[model samples]
Target: MKLAIVAVGHRQPDWISAGCSEYLKRLPPEMAARMIEIKPEPRGSKSREQLLAAERSRIDAALPASVRLIVLDEKGDDLTTLKLAGRLEQWQADGRDAALLIGGADGLDPALKARAAEKIRLSSLTLPHGLARLLLCEQLYRAVSVLKNHPYHREG
Candidate 1:
């Protein structure tokens, strides 16, 4: 099953795109993944709920069919690289596509988070959007490396 990262904020800097691309290309076909960027709703005067509602609409539209939904939240459970590797292995074994949703600056709708199969926190420290994207890609690659017993995962 392929993995899909549905994130808000479309126009990431070149380095962010390049960094994500490098790791994503390294993933094997069975763990193939893609990112879907949604345009951030204008923040001017809109309520948090309104902003989330607008963005969620786009996210739902972009999601692939029959995928297990996973959300990235600051308050979500922290997953170590090894744990992520185990989770990835299980997902692959299940043969179900996985969709990881990364919300806008305000984060995803509460109802969405509640319904997700899992909520993961990339870090305990707050990270800039670009850095967070890069880190996520890097970690996903590291997780895959661990699963395949590649030296890359241990080299660091």
Candidate 2:
């Protein structure tokens, strides 16, 4: 199944790109994983509402018509690594692409969140947007590895 991580903003730190790239390259050819960076609106003195609307529009545009939307938010469900792997397996079996969405600094827009079929949270603590992208990529790789019986994931 194809998995796409749709994140807001660009020009991230080198480490973020490197880390994400590492996992993307290692992902099995049959289970495609890619990161689509959604550029945030130009920030200045714009109102909070305006900024959110603009960012939401960009995210909406990046999503593919056939993919299932999954929003990443702090308030979303927290699942174990194994459970995440199982979930992806189910998605693959259902023949649907999983599109994971990461919001901008101000968090996800209400409209976008409402449209998501599933929601996930990385952790309770807040993380930098760039770092969050890298973290998500690593976790996705780990989940896939576990599902495929790779030695990369270890459960205590």
Worst 10 contiguous positions by lDDT, candidate 1: 147-156
Evaluate residue 77 in candidate 1 and report its C-alpha lDDT on the 0 to 100 scale. Answer: 83
Global fold similarity of model 2 (TM-score): 0.94
Candidate 1, lDDT over the whole model: 0.89
Best by lDDT: 1
Candidate 1 deviant stretches above 4 angstroms? none
lDDT of 2 at 103: 86
Candidate 2 lDDT tens digits, 39-146: 887779998778889999888787878788899999899988898898888888978887999988777789989988889899898899988998889988999999
Please report how far candidate 2 places residue 125 from its true position, in Å: 1.2
